[model samples]
Target: MVETGRIRVAKDKADLVKSLISTDGATGPFQTFADAIAFAAALGAKHNRRVPLGEISKREPSPIRLEYFASMGHDCVIKLLAITETKDIKILSLTEESEAKRNLIFEEYANGGLEILQNELRGAVDYSERILLMLCPEREQQEQQNEEFDLSKFLS
Candidate 1:
């Protein structure tokens, strides 16, 4: 029985970049959104709770995650977005992009599924029997569309 928290939405470029890092700066970088999800899971684990992807993604960008992504420049960020939108992006780094992007890439493409789930479960809220697994969903997920360039579309 896992208590899913909320999602963290990356508002701007900075926020999106921040979402790709681990809090402690001890690990290398998040290869996929699932790795980011694992980071969220790690965060929840550290606090003895389950943090929802929706909640984690929506969290405002803080200096805590490190503005390291900013230093990578727009070209790098574009590449990251492409990776984020990649279909079947793994929770772990299955590609060389991990080392190339400095580990700021994400895997899962969630279309803000939290609200949808909540709506379906509106009647009987039984979370105790549920176990949320962080996965690299086949679908594409993005917090918001970037005006600059979507790597997935561009590369395609």
Candidate 2:
């Protein structure tokens, strides 16, 4: 504990994230999907850039996901994540969510924190595979008059 004019502060980000995720601790970035949507609409009223939100999926069994992006940024995120028992090589955007999604969390740590977390997850699994499936519900239509902004040009 560090003292600042008599007010003490935890010396680490992990400490902060730890306290927040604990039961009876502060509530997370979103309480529910509707709350998330409303926060997104308001450009993040409860959370900010400095704080990373720990969001648990609302699906039955409710797996936790550490959000790297802000509320409004979550608008482009694919909602439904398919958890499979086996890993398929043909998938993109596929990465281990965590050792166990239920009550899972990734806290900021000093000294190879991410490496430790990834290593922990690496050895603990064969548990489940998480995949992102694209859902473009729009019907096929003819090309419009608007100019297409091709991102491929930036790749080279």
Q: Which candidate is the best by TM-score?
A: 1
Q: Per-residue lDDT for 5-87 in model 1, tens only?
A: 22233333233334344455423245434334333433333233321232233344422222333333323432444444344
Report RMSD for candidate 1. 17.1
- Please list the residue runs of candidate 1 whose C-alpha ends up more than 4 Å from where it truly belongs after superposition: 1-7, 10-84, 87-108, 130-156
lDDT per residue as tens, model 2, 2-25? 111111111332332232231344
The Cα RMSD of model 2 versus the native structure comes to 18.5
lDDT of each: 0.33, 0.25
On a 0 to 1 TM-score scale, where does candidate 1 land against the true structure?
A: 0.22
| Model 2 per-residue lDDT at 117 | 26
| lDDT (C-alpha) at residue 34 in model 1 | 36
